[model samples]
Each structure stands twice: as C-alpha cells, then as structure tokens.
Target: MPRTKGNHEARRRDVSEAVWRVLVAHGFGGLTMRAVAAELDATTGLLTHYFPAKRDLVAYALDLLERRSASRPRRAAGKGLSAVRAALLDILPLTDEATDSNRIWVSSWDAALANPELSDDYARKYAKSREKLRDLVAAAQQLGELPDGDPARIAAGAQSFVLGLVVQALFDPPAFPSHRQAELLDDYLATLNSPPSSGGDHEILS
Candidate 1:
C-alpha cells in the first residue's frame, strides 16, 4: 500500500503528540528515542525516519516546546506596572499546564548546557524574554509607578526572581502553592514602587 500525503501528515502529528507525552512525563533528561518510541507504541526505526540522531530529536522537541509556550494564552494587555505584573505572573507555574511546561523547561537546562548550539539558543530565548520585561519596566518607570533606575537591570532581577520561584514551586508544590506564589510576586513588585531613600541608592531596587 502506498502512503498518501494526508497519511504522512497524520503520522507526523502522531509523532509530535508522542514526543510531547514523553517530554511531560520524563522531561528532556528522559527524552530518548526509546522512550518516545515506547510512548508512541512505535519503533525507534520509525523515529529515525524523521530524526536521524539524538540531537535532532532533542532539537525538534525543544522547538515544539517553544511553540507550545508561545501559543499558550497570555495575560490581558495593560500598561505600566500592572502590565509588568501581568507579564511576570504569566511566567509562573500557577496552573497545572504551566507547571508541566516549567518542569520540562527546567529539565532542558542540563541538556542545553552540554550542547553549545542548544546553549546559544537558550541564551537568545532568555535575552528575548528579558527584553520584553525591560520594555515593560521602562514603561512603568516612565509612568512614575516604579522608582528611577536601570530598566534592564530591574528586568533581569525580576526574571531571576521569577525563575527562582519557579524552581522552588516545582520542588515543593505544597509549600509554594499558586496563591502563595502570586502573593510573593506582589510583594516583590511592591518593593519597586517604594520611593527612593535620601541616600539615593538605586541598588535597593536592583
């Protein structure tokens, strides 16, 4: 029997779904050709038809993760500090879906560190995320909602805080529930709104 274009497309979709399932269950560390094959109930030979090497498979999975992250619903648009808060909150693992995604993202760090190409890709992705936060921080400063300082520095700090929170939440779900996470984020943001001291040390915010 000859395979038609539709059949090939359907098979590709099945492969993608299988890859996602493997990622969610095992993270990148467990993302092997054998694991994906087991999830799909297919053979490694079939995966090889699509991805010739382990790196190829890993790269595809990473790209798939990025697409999923981008397509997920974002917080409603706003301005100033409110918008900054919304953007930061959107990154938290507040929902089950987000928790799973964050777990996969965290797991990818080891792989990214080992591979120079993947390391570069992750660096660019983080830079882009920081750039978005920086713009929002600059807007908030312009509106006088936040203290005067370097927007880029503030944004980097915010990103670091959120990522650290994410790891904590992932490790201790009982301790860092969604509401607690939100409250902590609010507390952090509130500090930014404080007026500068007589000492004029912007490092307080940084």
Candidate 2:
C-alpha cells in the first residue's frame, strides 16, 4: 500500500537520522544513500525520493543539527545560571552523542576549508552560537555568578574553552571530565565574589 504523506514525512525523518548516524560513525564519505537505506530498512531509491542529491541530504542533516542545537540555550535560560552552564556544555562533544555530532561537524568544518560554499553555513551557525553564548554569559553576570567583563568577550572565551574541550575529547575523551570542568567553573564563580582579603571589589580583579 502507498504510504500517506505523513507517513512519508516520518520515514524521511527516520532516513535523515539514519544518515546522521552513519555520518557520525564513519565520515562524510560513508553517508551514501545505501547506508541510510540499510539503516532505515528501505531501498536506496527511498532516500532519493526524499533527497534527490547527496548534497541535499547533507545540507538537510546539517540544518537539522543547527536547529536542534540552537534551541538548547533558549530553553535553559529560564532555569538561570546553572541551567545555562548545563545547556552550553551540551555543545561540547563530551558524551557519545555529542561526539557523534562533533565527528560530523568537524568533518563539515574541514570540508569548508576547501569549499567556500559550505563556509556560509559555518559562519551562520557560528554567529548564532556566539550570540547564544553571549546571552548566557550576560545572564550569569547579571546574577553575579560571573565577573563583569565584556559579556561578548567572555562569551567568546567560554566558547573557545568549550571548543578546546571538544577537540581534546576527539583525541582523549576523558581528558576534560565533567566533574573537573565543573570544579574549574566553580573556581571561576568564586572569583566573581568580593575577595574579603582584598578591598571591596565585588567584580573580581578589581
């Protein structure tokens, strides 16, 4: 029987996710329609039905990641600083799932070096991500949980830190354990408070 449009759409998502899994597990080279078909238990033609070209499929998967990741911070905003930290950390490739994403993402980043066309997508995602981090850092400062540095700069630095951790995880997954990261984060928080030993400079480094 022919599937309805809704069923087809659901199946399309299933195929897309399957492609994502293959891309992460293997590499961009592994994201052939055959792989997605194997994962979805569908025919190779089925993937072509949804994404006529391999490039289209790649773009769709990348956009899906961008949108899914973009929503993490906004939802965490209501929960405040702790929530922000949790949400922002989600971007780091710490866990298996994040590592999977990073596998594909770093590949995409490398691809961008040779393909200027893909670089546009990278820039767009980067801008949106930095803005989200900026908002989180600004919120932390407002709550007195962070020092009153330039929020944008702090955001950039925090993003840099997470990026470093992600790259480190690619080589050594246990390098930046979450507990230690949290300890360092807390240490930074400590600096935000007025040093009783020093004069009255609540903002730290005063």
Candidate 3:
C-alpha cells in the first residue's frame, strides 16, 4: 500500500532520529544503513524505503543535527543580552547532549565538504544562524545591553569564537572546561557591553 505524504514524512522523521542516534554513537565513519536499522530495531529494507541511497540518509542525518541544535530550549532567553547569550551558548559543547551533537557536527563536516548538496546545505544553515545572531546583537545594542558598533561584525566574531572554543573543549576538556567556557563567554560579552571610549582621551607612550 502506498503511504500518505504525512505518514511518509512522519516515518522519515522517525528514521532520521534513529540515524541521529547511530551518528552520535559511532560518528560518520560508522554510519550505515545496517547500523541505523539496528538502532531502530528494523531491517535495512525499511530504511531504504525512505532513503534509497546512503548519501540521502547521511544528508538527512546531518540536517537532523542542525535542526536539533537550533531547537534547543529557549526558556532562558527572556531578556536582550541574555537571549543572545543563551542562543550562542546553545551551540557550544557544554553539556553531554551538546557534546554529542558537536561530535556529530564535526563528524559530518568531511562528508559535507565532499558533497556539494551537503556543503550548500551547511552553508545556508550557517548563514541563517549568523543572521539570527546579528539580529540578536542589534536587539541587545538597541536595548543598551551591548555597545554600538557593527552588529554584523560582532555576530561574525562571536560565531567564530564559539566555534573555536567548541573545538578546543572537544579536544581537551581537562584544559578547557565547560565552566571556563562560560566564564570566557561572559567576559567577551562584558567587553561588548562596555561603554565606548570618549573621543578626547589621549594616549602617551614612552
């Protein structure tokens, strides 16, 4: 029997979630239809019903990671800067769940680089995320929670900094602990929240 579109999408979502579990447990290298089927306690034939090819499944899995990361709880973002901070911190590998998601992202990168569809999809997702960050920065600035400057530039810098810290924390948790990451983020935002220097200030060097 032919499945309805809604049912097909629901099944796809369920299969993609199983794929996500396999990706998180085994990374990209270990992902396969068999592994995903095993995760779902199903046969590869059922998975292939929705995703006929491995690339299709991989793309869906990577897309799932992006969606999951973006959908993190937002109950903490009640204010301007706090909202921005909460959004940015959600991307970091701070908790066990976040760490697993970051690992999946890292694992998917090499494959994304090789596949044009994946690459374009990743680029689009990142561009959208940066735009959201820029909007948050602009909001904070308007609310006097952040200093006035180029909000776009600030957003780009913040994104880069967070990505770098994610890598560092993933590589060496002992050296770059999660609390330290939070402290550094607070310090960075504090700098952004600082008042602009007066124009009449003079510097003398010897």
TM-score to native of every candidate shown: 0.91, 0.75, 0.79
lDDT of 3 by residue, 1-206 (tens): 57799978887777877888898888998999999998888899988886899987876777788788778655477668998899878888888888888988888888889889878988997888899999999998899888889999999999988988888898898987889999988888887788867665565322
- Report lDDT (CA) for all predictions: 0.92, 0.69, 0.85
If both were scored by lDDT, which would come out higher, candidate 1 or candidate 2?
1
Model number with the top TM-score: 1
Return the number of clashes found in candidate 1.
0
Residues 95-145, candidate 1, lDDT per residue (tens digit)? 999998898899889999998988998999999999999999999999988
What is candidate 3's local distance difference test score?
0.85
Error (Å) of candidate 1 at residue 161 is: 0.6
Say which prediction, candidate 2 or candidate 3, comes out ahead on TM-score: 3
RMSD of each: 2.5, 4.8, 4.2
Instruction: Report the alpha-carbon TM-score of model 3 versus the true structure.
Output: 0.79
Model 1 pairs whose backbones collide = none
Candidate 3, residue 30: Cα displacement in angstroms equals 2.0
Ordered list by lDDT, greatest first: 1, 3, 2
Candidate 3 wrongly placed segments (more than 4 Å): 1-14, 41-46, 195-206
lDDT of 2 at 128: 75
